[model samples]
Target: MTDRYVQATMDVLGAARDVFSGHDTWRPLEEAIDAQLPDDYKALIDAYGPVQVNGHLYLEHPANPFYPLRTWISETIEDFRDVDWGEEDSPQFGGKAGLIPIASTDRGEYAFLAPGNDGGQSRIFSCGRDEPDLYEHRMTFAEWLYRYLAGEEMFSPGHRDFYPGPVRLESLPTAAGDRSSKWYGQERST
Candidate 1:
């Protein structure tokens, strides 16, 4: 059901809050985490196994002028069984990229939409990671677009990465990048 994805994302948030709400200085269990099912998210669990939510791949602690804290939920490609997540011979990401992610942290909610110009291509946006007022203003972008496409299971940053696609190097722009100043990453090369 459409609501299922929301529930799964919520479950993860609950766990995060439990661990983070208490202190001003708190980090996740690890940079690279293999999502452990919270029982409630059992249905959300992928057939392959639990999803790869927050990871070092998304969050780079490097000391750069651009922001770094890029936390997000990464899902395997097969999660989208029928969807053409990524095509073969994609130059950038190379091969099939199955792990799609809904990126979020203290930065904001953004989705690595899908691979376009080869595996290295993607469309990122603030999903629900906007400020209180902003979140209210946006977030329905992906929802509306996916609906127009008539996609059965739309990809939410926090939902299961069911789409089988590629994770190209060029697409890894930090939230601070021109893509939108929604989060902190790197400045887009004009």
Candidate 2:
């Protein structure tokens, strides 16, 4: 079953990549499948039966919603505590987080996301019968990489979640020869 699903996933993704790129606002379920499904994704298929992402059924979107196989979230950004957390319905929090289903022509629909506890960082869980309420669990940076996408530093600053500043160099190498030194002319000419 897993092998068949993975094979079907690949076929759908190939076509989704083409159509999804153009429709930025309304995307095909194939996009996520193409992006995340692994070559041997069958090995990772969920053993606990089917699951949902956000409130949508695993494959409920207009396009087919592929079972995530497994979903993960990581904390790549910093300063989330700095953001002014607010109502979930607010523009900042509402649309910012949810189950984002990716399209797949063959296997079906797929999703990727970082759902917030109160429009903020907390645990990530797959949507199911009880949805986030039942499936939710703590997700930390050490465990997942996808959490990085949740915070948009440049676009939404008030949202506390910010990317780390560019790394800086701390030290320099010694001059090989006095003649080659940047200070060479300063002392000699003086």
Candidate 3:
């Protein structure tokens, strides 16, 4: 079932056949986070690398130093902590301790995983801008991805809608010195 879902997601996203990093690349991140990333996420990254879905959602990839999972998680947590959750209009960032940001939207909304809950399998929590705003989905990352790609409104329910279309797969831009770029004249003149 999970394999089917992963394949479906890849098919829908029009991802390339070769973008995966080896398991060795993922080991350090798992060790740092002290949790095994969802198989679905690993598979998705393996097929698509890091990508922006529909020009809105951003998923972290381990290979991209700029937006690696570890860095994004830590920075997001710190930023969330700095926000005042006391205000009625403020978003509840730290309401659920150990909630890790997995995906974020362009509108400052995020999808989190409550690893401390449900015996560590993780539950999906999303904070959106609307009444009955914060909600949890008792589904695995794979299932949630399937529903999301299917435009089922699984996260925000009636408040959000997604139209299924040609999903775009974009490579995360690396830093100037990170690699030799032919376009930037970083390649050695031979």
Candidate 4:
């Protein structure tokens, strides 16, 4: 099942190889989160590395120094705590516990995963800066990705400004001489 999701995503994005560092590189991030990340996310990173989908969605990678997943998750959680979004009932915006951000958009929208509910399954929460309400989807990361790529209205109906044409995946440049990083300059294909 996990392989199918990874294959489907790669097929849709035209990804050619497993450009990212494997499970060893992801250890620190998983430890920080205190929970194992979804298998679908691991497969996505393993296959595509750090990528921007259609120049709109940015998925954090283990080797991204500027916006590593650990930093992004911690910072976003802190930011949610600092700002008063006026929704006390909301866990993500109101500083309620058990939610972590997974992906962020160029448009200031974010996708979060909330665990410890519904028998340990994670639920996805999509929210934008301008909107007070959040869009919730009770699916795994792979299911969500499949629906998102299929243009399902339920994922993000109002914000449909994504590049509707063929999807493009651009590999971000890594630091020079960083051989330990998966995005090392020499390893990148032109």
- List clash counts for every candidate, in order: 11, 18, 0, 0
* Candidate 2 per-residue C-alpha lDDT over 30-80 given as tens digits, one digit per residue, 9 for 90 to 100: 243222222232121221112221222222112112312212111101112
RMSD of 4: 5.8
The candidate scoring highest on lDDT is 4
Model 1: worst 10 consecutive residues (lDDT sum): 42-51
- Per-residue lDDT tens digits for candidate 1, residues 68-145, read 222223232222234342557331211223223333333333333232333432333333334221111122223422
lDDT of 3 at 116: 57
Better of 1 and 4 by TM-score: 4
Q: Name the TM-score of candidate 4.
A: 0.77
lDDT of each: 0.27, 0.24, 0.62, 0.64
Q: Identify the candidate with maximal TM-score.
A: 4
Tens digits of lDDT, candidate 3, 42-86:
777666656666566677777776557678877887776575556
When sorted by lDDT, best at the front, the candidate numbers are 4, 3, 1, 2
